[model samples]
Target: MICAGDDDEDPFPVEDCLFAETFSQDTAFTLFGQELRIQQVFGGNLGVAAAVWEAALHLCSYLEERSVEVRGRRVIELGAGTGVVGILAARLGAVVTLTDLPLTLPQLEANVSANTPSSGWPATLPTVLPLSWGQDHMNFPSDWDLVLCADIIYLPETYPLLVRTLAHLCKNTAVVYLSSKMRKEHETPRFFEECLPSRFNVELVHLDGSQNINIYRASLRKDLSQDLD
Candidate 1:
């Protein structure tokens, strides 16, 4: 329902727009037993990426409920948007890197700074970086324990690039956890059905039928792993 881009011609679902307006500049969320204050920028050139999506919250809940082992792990979040999921992972003791497009970094950085503690965790603090999928993915280290993505597969044009980036980042035992809303208009199924399976063995670990959101766990295919080596 959220508009994908800043184009005037882009279709903006009325219900989604109304939902967006319900938030103030800063919204608070309780995840992983901590309160996080996330700043949201609406109706800008940033589009839907500036706001915290339902998929991000659902992913956070899944991680918390499943007791995912992120502690002391090398985790990176792509298309981080409001930085909620990555920040939550950091709170859970992971060395997290939150990445998004160049324009989205400022807000993302702000949210990370506001939510993340100044110090005291055994793990390294979360870092923020700008990563455009496929364009500069090679600049990043291929060695990661976990790759987190939330609501990033809406744009079909970026599907191949996203898959390529995932294939590169998920080396050895690295796993990817992606949460997305099943919006038919955005062709959300195509990324899971076609793009991701091309590089990784993807599984639907959880599904929230009420919200139409899905959480997928993916790992590099054995064949692709051999090819990378």
Candidate 2:
């Protein structure tokens, strides 16, 4: 199923045809303390991921009251399927870098350009690039202050790659924010539970009143010695 941000110019027409929907009408959501323009898409088998995005947006609104040094912080988002989380962070004063597989870069950039109005991006808006997990380390400014991913831990085979990518990108005190719907039936929660805590201090933030969905926050443990093993 195609998520809401899938582009129309996908060259792999066969793979592109696998998705049922195209970019939907632009919808507005406030995430990470900034107003973001979003397109709701069909997650197909990844419906839970879409739900997680909704939950994160709700949490973002609630966190607005309490500032947490986001201004001018370098950030990177991995497996940015729909670019929702990354784009929102850019609006919230973080210098975000959005990445996904090369196939998804066009859609990702389209999403960024669509959300970012011509009035001009705050000098803090993010840059979009083709970053695949475990492919190669991105040569950027410095270690990221924050790394974000929404519903990225869906495949068990992807765990090792994600760990390596996160380790290379995050700073000593970097905080990584990940959100999911806890879809136990899909084995996603189990995948995260078994893999993430080995290197990060995983915390399940209860996204209760503000939104009707479940979400969590995982911050990297500063002292982890997780190796390439």
Candidate 3:
């Protein structure tokens, strides 16, 4: 069933251990004059996926203040666990595609539908699809202006495939934005530098505290690895 919560309620009980395990809710997040309702898949408090989405929303608001128009852009968010970022992008006027592994698509779709824009707003909401990082290339749209991902790089096995998928799917002008909480040795930037030399242009734009999560703008360019020393 669909769980709902008001603005002031923390719904998840931090005190009780058992009550925190199974319940999930659709929470409302407001920023930049846009009210986005997102679904928390695993219940309790906001998980790591939603936390990263919160950070991404903050960054989006920061950019919006600087006159960066997020509206009417083609955006794709990979590994969208709870579909928070992509759904927010749609609410802000972008045509977004939210994708994750096949198993996660159902919940993702529910989140997308739960957070859809109002009637007077934009007509097209985000499209939810099944896209495994390196496995399935089942008809993705070309010429995307922006690609977003959050908290997907913790697993080292998926590094190469992630880079290659970004290279193949994103256009030359496409900006890839990613955020993650890395372990002590699992630096996502290092993974990008190691794998992106041959096919894409990689630049580290922002790094959060503790050097764990980072924002990168990866664009497609020729001979991008010339400076990979």
lDDT of 2 by residue, 8-113 (tens): 4431112334346543456676555356676544433323222225545544553464455566888777767568777766766678888766656666676788
In candidate 1, the residue pairs with backbone N, CA or C atoms under 3 Å apart (3 or more residues apart, or in different chains) clash, namely none
Best by TM-score: 1
- For candidate 2, the lDDT comes to 0.60
Model 1 stretches astray by more than 4 angstroms: 1-24, 118-121, 226-229
Per-model TM-score versus the true fold: 0.88, 0.74, 0.75
| lDDT, residue 140, model 1 | 93
Locate the minimum summed-lDDT window of 10 residues in model 1: 10-19
lDDT of 3: 0.63
lDDT values, one for every candidate: 0.82, 0.60, 0.63
* Model 3, span 53-86: residue lDDT tens: 4446544654555565668988888877777677
Taking all chains together, the TM-score of candidate 3 against the true structure is: 0.75
RMSD of 3: 8.7
lDDT of 1: 0.82
